[model samples]
Target: MASKIFHPIFFILLIFIPLAPIGHAKRSSPSDKNSSPFNFIKKLKGCQKGNSTKDIHELKAYLEKFGYFSYENNAHAMDDDFDDTLESAIKTYQKNYNIKPSGIVDDETISKTTTPRCGVPDIANSINYMQPRDNNHESSSSNIHTVSHYSFFPRSPKWPSSKTYLTYRFISNVPTYARAPVARAFQKWYSVTQFSFEQVPTNQNSDLVIGFYRRDHRDGFPFDGPGGVLAHSFAPTNGRFHYDAEERWSVGSVPGSYDLETLALHEIGHLLGLEHSRVNEAIMFPTFSAGQVKNLHPDDIQGIRALYNQ
Candidate 1:
């Protein structure tokens, strides 16, 4: 039930302003173009190329960092050719970065590959615009769950059955540090609801697949440079959770670190049919300030209870 006032409108407005002009601008001719800045990084040449015939563990490792492959080794057959794997990896990279999904190595793909992952710029400015002016709620803990006007419509469907348990899966291709916080995120919901949940390794039969990536992966919600929206999730039928690969997700009990657990908890709340909460105290608030999601408030509990009650 975190405050739902933090709508995507704020972020959309910022992106639209800068991008509108670029979309309408005339394209530069190839002949008029000078030396390309991305000409040098046209291939995966910096790292030692693994044996093309052997299983390319190193190549997989490299691609996984950018959310290309699922971390679960068994999800993909080991016998698959490294070249083919690399092709898929390249394609996902292209999709996230807004390039065409050709699955072929090209100059544009190389250029984007080398660029660092970060959220959208002007995030601070956008947050300021959307948030209240001269608000002094930081010191007051009692108002955390107070409902406000910005909440969206609750989208919960009828419960399948009281006996029908809900399941969630977090499938990550990033490193261990990135995937570790997911457990605590699930726990956030279990803390308030009567439902039982567990994290399953990515497999062919898994009900939900949570994949993380930076820019483009498979779905159309291409991640902007690190700071824009932290991540996005598909609706119920397509339960896919994708993270912006550019984020250095924090996973511990620290003050300033970005809590991966907290973020995932919020997103999963979305997955569970909850929309953004009008109450700032709820964990489902659309935007998060640093170190703000240590716990869930009563509004979140109320929403979940309403959904699960048959």
Candidate 2:
């Protein structure tokens, strides 16, 4: 949306270009110092101590997406110099993710940002209309637009018990390995809620639809091809879960591999209508690692149970 200097981040390929292919199949971590976007960012300067650059704009957009920055000023945040707002946002992001609160966009911070995360906003306030919007939910505080804790979109939506015995269908065309974690992800949520998910073939209509897509696959929020976002799901009753087919998705704890199960678990929370959590230990937390395995945190359980009356 701007010049080459101000194009959205990720447009820059590393000068050395040792990073893996960009796709949901994988999102590199800081450990991949030799080839990650973080490594590229770490080599730069002027992104700290109230100094900004074009990269800072990208970072600002990222922070807004994950709930660190406000949605109010999202339209005009393209400053080439870092400001107090960016510093504070970086600190909050670091604190939530357990990074040292340095207020700098260091290698670790950029690496984590590049990690696969749900394409959904940390909290919605009528900004993303890719799916249905509910405006009935009240705000916890007027000052804060979005918080990191497990929250509800507008009205704290939930599936009724009549729909408890839900059915889902995986995009039949993807590799079989994708099925393992997708199925397990549904079961994981089933263990805690009144809901029980059954898989139906794509030919038949299902309550939930799961599939892989790449770039602007027509649901409004487009996948940026590789590292920036992993997958996204619409809020409950909407029942749409989409993964970036471009990602190098893995089924298990493969180092340097993006865990489909971990991501599926997080996205399912969204399908069930739960928001991102402030608790770093919570499955609903906004950020995750390449090989992370997380069970439902109390906050996650409470949020879902509260919505479902379980």
Candidate 3:
């Protein structure tokens, strides 16, 4: 197989950037009828680069929390002015979610802003994983030939080759009902990858740990109640996965409740070093809706295989 190369422009990402609080979501579907974490954004819609509103500061903070705003921009994040920096960040965010890069708070941008998403930033450490990558190689095994939307954390971290089989355990405080759905999520991943998973006793240290917590759990990355962030996990070798206990989570399709298995698959992808995919159908897509059940897309398969050289 020919060695595949990603374009240099696609690989650059900042490191050690601080994370701010991302926006929240509506309690229900995309119908635009419920409480939103970013309801303030709706009022600021149509505002652009020279416009200023007291709510603009909230918008600035929203962008900063999700890895769109830069450190230098913090000086202006507290102010109500919509400056050039805020416009730039909005453009980047718009481009990320496939909204037009108008740099204005348009209806489409507002809709995305209010959607429930993972706590992990779409552009973690300054790497906008939502950007598409050119995949020109013909896999000798699968013979896939096409562009890909899958991406990785900064430096593409992963589990060591020697540790093909991993043991995972739920924290003692995790809800009893969440275990089965989460376990099923692990089974789905094992079917696609060159790895196997085993559930171990909580008393034993395992390769991965899963838990649920409410606001400010002290993990550096805090949960933002019922709607905003569903869950988040670290890149490989960290193995800490957390779900927001405040969410209305269920094992199957239920109105106003997030499907546990679907989100578990997503966070597990992060645990395995896969970043958010721009392809909306892919489970790795940054935002997920309530009562939604998503399966692994081909882009997800291609990405993981490419990452581990499978």
Instruction: Give a tens-digit lDDT track for model 2, residues 1-310.
Output: 1111111111221232223333334544554335433334544343686564556676666677655666356455766567788788778766656678898878777666666667777535533212223532333566865322456766667786576777888776555667767777777788787777777777999899988887788888888755557788888789999887765556666655577778889899999988776567888876666656777776688778777766
Model 2 bad stretches (over 4 Å): 1-46, 70-76, 98-102, 106-111, 126-149
Model 3 is weakest, by summed lDDT over 10 consecutive residues, at 5-14
How much lDDT does candidate 3 score?
0.78
The per-residue C-alpha lDDT of model 1 at residue 1 equals 31
Better of 1 and 2 by lDDT: 2
Task: Please list the Cα RMSD from the true structure of every candidate, rounded to 1 decimal place.
Answer: 18.9, 12.1, 9.9
Superposed on all Cα atoms, model 2 deviates from the true structure by an RMSD in Å of: 12.1
Candidate 3, residue 91: CA error in Å?
Answer: 1.3
Please give the lDDT score for candidate 1: 0.47
What TM-score does candidate 1 reach? 0.48
lDDT of 1 at 299: 59
Q: Give candidate 2's total backbone clashes.
A: 20
Query: What are the runs in model 1 whose C-alpha is more than 4 Å off?
Result: 1-155, 253-257
